[model samples]
Target: MGTSTAYGGPGGGTPLVPSWLGSDGDAGGLASPSAPPAGAPTKDPASPATLPPAPPTRLAIPTPADGSRFTAPRSNFTRFAGSGGSDRASLGRAVSGYVSKSSGGARQAAQRMGASRGSGARLLGFLTDVQARGATEALRSLDLEGLAGRPIDEVFMGLADYICPNAGTVDEGIAREAFIETIVDLSTLGVTDLDALSPDQMQTVFELYATHAIEARLCNDIGTKLVTAPTDPLIALRVQSQLRDFIRNGVSDALTAARAETPNLTQDRVHTFVDTIYERAFGILQTLGDAEADQ
Candidate 1:
């Protein structure tokens, strides 16, 4: 089959989307750019489906100072170029140009995808929904091929696996690993680039991961009042940053320390501001934990 596969002795095989690919939905405003709809690609005997995405030599990390800014940074490339990027071979470069290349790319994705299948988990479907939505957003903002120098599919697969390996199969631990990796990876993406992500693109990221923001409204009315209305609003600032850091680092350290504890630990002022997310996030966690225990 390897030697004869290229000969095309039989009539051209069916022209259809592969079974591995699914019909990704258009999430609200997110857009899904199908990988380059190339003439039915001739499969290499060695490489099925498509060649693997280029492995990154190094991860691309935005400067930490620049990371703190909420505005769109300078365009490393021109505006999103998915439509214009050449699909000649799929991605031109690899993951490095778009996101950081960590030590465990393939092994991690494979592990996540593999473990999910073994866990009798429903996490994959949920994550697939998430990825498709995120993919939609990322596609709209990115230069699909020029960024990769490959077909949009390569970009999609690269991003998809990176974001949710074994999206439809992984267990909780693998799912958690993949989720953390994705958020960390997205942090490197420019705000403009992230804001430009298609629905499918945004789907892979988190609901709370806002790329652009205004610092002035960092807190709501209640929060301002709770902090003695400090001009700096120190405590509220501390919590917000702690949550942000948790999202990035998975809560390794707590924001509140004995020495740093605020003198004013009273008043219901901040509760109004923090209650909404705290209630919801905690509720979801409690519910999920209960469900897992029951199972």
Candidate 2:
């Protein structure tokens, strides 16, 4: 039997909506402009109603209480809480389970974002490209506007398809890891609230998530290698150091490229993204060590 990889975090629970998406009027959350300064005067019945809330001028990632930066958790399998197995087979069960537990609001939010016929096709292409290549290339090659306008479900379903192309044959554990990684990546993009985004902007966020997922998975693989190796202590130490450097350099390159490609990228977001990569790398190392010690 294949030994289970303790990917970290308990699996299965309600999907946590990004805090920014909350209805509360916190910074980065919904904006309800001070009820028009204590209602100085009531406007005409319908004199060209005020425009929608302006898109946020700035975005920020939440910081932890300990004053450390936020990093995406190793897994969000709790979103699939109560699912049977912890392995990849459990991933298959979770996938089918989520379809029936669809959130009406999530669906509506997706529809409002544009789940029309033509847009769905474009969304599919964009998702496919992001999965096959990295998010950066997908952004450069795909129709950003079209993909952004598609429904959230369309984008998510596309991701699901990519994760479980052949339910019968795909490795359940691998699929689970990909799904968790994607969630963690999306979380780092600081876009909990979809209303804060335009179609094109949303597409960019998706691309970023996809790219990060790919990177995170690589880090996880490296950590597995480090922990599982039965080599000499000195050689293992050298290998561990090399793997850590590789992850650091890779993250730096990705961030630099992302900033160059999207000038509007916020400093906080970039920092959070960088922290996420390092945190995952280090977290994996820690977990691997713990597991080996127990062995």
> What tens digits encode model 2's per-residue C-alpha lDDT throughout 26-103?
124433676454324455566856544544444555332211111222121221111221232322222222212321
Could you give candidate 1's per-residue lDDT for residues 114-217 as a string of tens digits? 22222112222323332445434334443342333333334434454433344331122333343443345555653224324554343334332211000011
Please list the C-alpha lDDT of all candidates, in the order they appear.
0.27, 0.34
TM-score of each candidate structure, all chains considered together: 0.19, 0.26
Maximum-lDDT candidate: 2
RMSD (Cα, Å) of model 1? 26.1
Screening candidate 2 with a backbone cut-off below 3 angstroms (N, C-alpha, C), the clashing residue pairs are 12-77, 12-78, 12-80, 12-81, 13-78, 13-81, 88-172, 88-173
Q: Which candidate should be chosen as best, given TM-score against the real structure?
A: 2
Q: How close is candidate 1 to the true structure, as a TM-score?
A: 0.19
Residue 201 in candidate 2, Cα distance off native in Å:
6.0
